[model samples]
Target: MRYDLDTRNRALTLLRDGVSNAEVSRRLGIPSGTVAWWLHRDRARNGGLPGAHRSTCHTCHGDPLDRTAYGYLLGLYLGDGHIFQSGKHRVPNLTIACCEDWPGLIDAAEDAVRRVFPHNSPCRVRRVGCTYVKVYSKHLDCHFPQHGPGKKHTRHIQLAPWQREIVDEHPWELIRGLVHSDGCRITNWTTRRGKRYEYPRYFFTNVSDDIRRIYTDALDRVGIAWKETRRGSTPYNISVARRESVQVMDVHVGPKF
Candidate 1:
């Protein structure tokens, strides 16, 4: 693997240095065909060129630009070596109309993705639809483990093929957590003039080991007493001691801080 990597890099440098592929291959004692393959694969892996190959040369006939045709091209790209074998994908259900408008949709999605995941590397559009599109990125799938060992965890849906593929490819990215929100009632609600009475209540919609750790750390930091409660038809709630509210700034750090 190291020898191959070194040879491939040397071939790329030669190509970039204006040395002919055939000449490079001959000088390196490697086949010209092999050199060409290496050069193409290297460029594609680095996102310098499209990841897949064309079936036939386009000089003889105009290439098909139709969405249906591009779907196959997109699939080829997705399955190519450019995508890290460790990372998996989320299968998107695309409509014909969306696929037909893929180019424009891709342009829009690129802009949106940059704003949210600015550090994220560029992703090639692997597929598209009226309402959905699949993009190749460093994202991986996360799964919630089953309640107990020896039992399949069907409570949460399993990751789809694309997602599983990515997850398997990049196991380090999997993160588990629970999402929570709070609702409150005013203290003056019971008084005749307390029209806006507030009761502080927060609930957890999902629970995982990670969630328990986070809440535990938070409560410990504030020196506040906390209790978990469950009631009829609602959800799991956490009641926090109201003796004193912790300063928000002390709880969160800003870049400048």
Candidate 2:
């Protein structure tokens, strides 16, 4: 039921632009009551009531670094990261769960968190077989506009203008992040005309159509070609099996390690 600052701001903006609360709620997937409450609160604050003030966070300010860090974080978030408000105080926490087998990925995620929020420290939580890199910050939601309730596939996913700018500028970093989280590089062996051959390729799998489109769009931006592979049902896979396509992916995404 907790809404991020970005969501609240977006809802308020839409309302100011003459959008109905029900329409905004339907579009943003926010409850109608929440929208009404926000509008009422805004009106009260504008009325100059005592102790009625707008909340401000780091996002109200500008980003410290360029979009590289944010692009990487966004990819990771779309793949395996999650954000939620917890505790009695309702503090927002961002957690990126990476497989323990990939220590390098864990390290990379931690490094990105540090670079994105130098003031906040990230912690690691060890589950049964996965390690979660977690950070507590209100501003985390600002960087990831795609954060919302339920599974990503069931919800709408769209990149904001700033996010698009980042991905456009550094598609490789975005690809690296997505590949490290949801994709893998492997060597495939096959027999062709009584000959055994080995080839290297990359595979990406996700259930969210929007997320899959984002990944494919990034690949297209980098001039890498990928094709859809039938993977049973639900989750879909994108494979880069062609030699030239594999080469392009290798140059940008490389191996997760």
Q: Pick the candidate with the highest TM-score.
A: 2
Q: What lDDT is obtained when candidate 1 is compared to the true structure? A: 0.37
Among residues 3 or more apart in sequence or in different chains, the pairs in candidate 2 whose N, CA or C atoms overlap within 3 Å are none
Can you write out model 2's per-residue Cα lDDT over 54-122, one digit (the tens) per residue?
333346765465468767877888999999886664668888999999899999999988877776779
Q: How close to the true structure is residue 188 of candidate 2, measured as C-alpha lDDT?
A: 97
Per-residue lDDT tens digits for candidate 1, residues 163-251, read: 34443332211211111111121232243565654533223222333333334444455354556666675335554435343222123
Please report how far candidate 2 places residue 86 from its true position, in Å: 1.8
- How far residue 165's Cα lies from its native spot in candidate 1, in Å, is 29
Off by over 4 Å in 2: 1-58, 232-235
In model 1, how many backbone clashes occur? 18
lDDT score at residue 10, model 1, on the 0-100 scale: 82
Model 2's C-alpha root-mean-square deviation from the true structure amounts to 14.3
